[model samples]
Target: MVEYPHPVDIKVHQKSRFLDIAFDDGSHFSLPCEYLRVYSPSAETRGHSPATAKLERGKEMVSITQIEPVGQYAIKIHFDDGHNSGLYDWRYLYNLGKHHDELWQAYLDKLKAVGYQRKDPELAPPDVDV
Candidate 1:
């Protein structure tokens, strides 16, 4: 079993599209909803084989609609895009927070390599914003 810091608070900021988590170890992080969905533990993203992991794209506007507790160890995040299979355990969440920078950079690099573009809010028409 992987030992990890348990969360003291989990706050979903809809306006910012991020989940702020404070752990018992004094580590606090604001994990973006898009980041969570793209890196979902579900096979749809990271499968049994590394090569099977899909390069998630166009999720720039994705947000978590609900967060369901799974027993006492994990959470099943419900995304507005209908994804709810990823079970983010305490350890996994901790790891995500701890290594957010590197992970996010990697995802961006991968997307660039594959020519996958995430919807950019800045690119929106002047009349509307996403």
Candidate 2:
């Protein structure tokens, strides 16, 4: 069985759609919801084979709508887009959290290569001056 260093604390910053996870081993990470959604372990995201995996887009602002415990090893996360099939094992989650920076940067690069923007270009920026 894979062993995970106990999490010293887990803080979900809903406004930022980021989870700050700190392990007792003195390691910590901030995982964005969009990254989690796109990297989901669900077959729908990763597919049966890597070549068959669908490239996800326009999810830079996605959020976790719910998090359900799955036994002692995993958590099933429900995304705002209705995807809830991924059962995130503790080890997987820990790995993702640990490598969030590299993974997220890679994802951004992929999005740029595909000429995809995270948010709609046609939409005007929200008016901040009032």
Candidate 3:
């Protein structure tokens, strides 16, 4: 079995809308709340497979409301937008941090391809049903 580097410290910077995590392997990441929310591992977001994965939109200003530890391996992140199903495991979190740039760019590209315009949450129109 492989031993994964566990998180030694996790801090939620509410004001900045990002989570700072440090691992035992000398790795650290400052993950944006919007990024985490869009890349959530929940079935509603990731689905059962890549082909079924849903595209998350309108989350530019979303923030983390809370984070609950799931036993010894993962954490459940609660978003301010009411999404709280994803279980972010140690390895998965590490990978997200490691490949942040690429993953973020891919997400942006996907949104653009689907014709979704990202805009500031405050200036967005009220309750335009998708």
Candidate 4:
């Protein structure tokens, strides 16, 4: 069984799309929204098996639209893209926060190997016709 060390503070920096988590043990970490989005534990993201997990790209700008507490152990985060099924337990969140650098780099390498870009390239900027 996994246990989460209680956090002394959890601050969401909306502009940067990062979460600054401070633990009671005086450890702290800053995690990006893109990292959280790609690593979401929802079935839609992680799938039923590791072999079936779908690759998620174009989510570099994804942000948490809502964060709702689920009982006393987890948080339900709703993404801007309408995905809200992942239940991020405290322990899981803590682990992610602690191992963010390694996990994030691995994800980036996977994306690069697959030729996946984190931002959409098809959207055109609006222009006024003269």
Clashing pairs in 2: none
Residue 84 in model 3: lDDT: 99
Candidate 3, residues 14-77, lDDT tens digits: the string is 7667788899999989888888999999999999999999999989888888899999999999
- At residue 63, candidate 4 shows an lDDT of 73
Model 2 ranges with Cα > 4 A deviation:
6-8, 120-130
Best-fitting candidate, measured by TM-score?
1
- Estimate, for each residue in 6-44, the C-alpha lDDT of model 4 and write its tens digit: 766776666567767777777787777677888998998
CA lDDT scores, all candidates in order: 0.86, 0.77, 0.87, 0.77
Best by lDDT: 3
Q: What's each prediction's TM-score?
A: 0.89, 0.81, 0.89, 0.84
lDDT of 2 by residue, 1-130 (tens): 6569766566656666776667767888777777789999999998999898878897766777888878866789888888899788777888998887898888888888998877732322122111
Q: How accurate is candidate 3 locally (lDDT)?
A: 0.87
lDDT of 1: 0.86
Ten-residue stretch with the least lDDT total in model 2: 121-130
TM-score of 2: 0.81
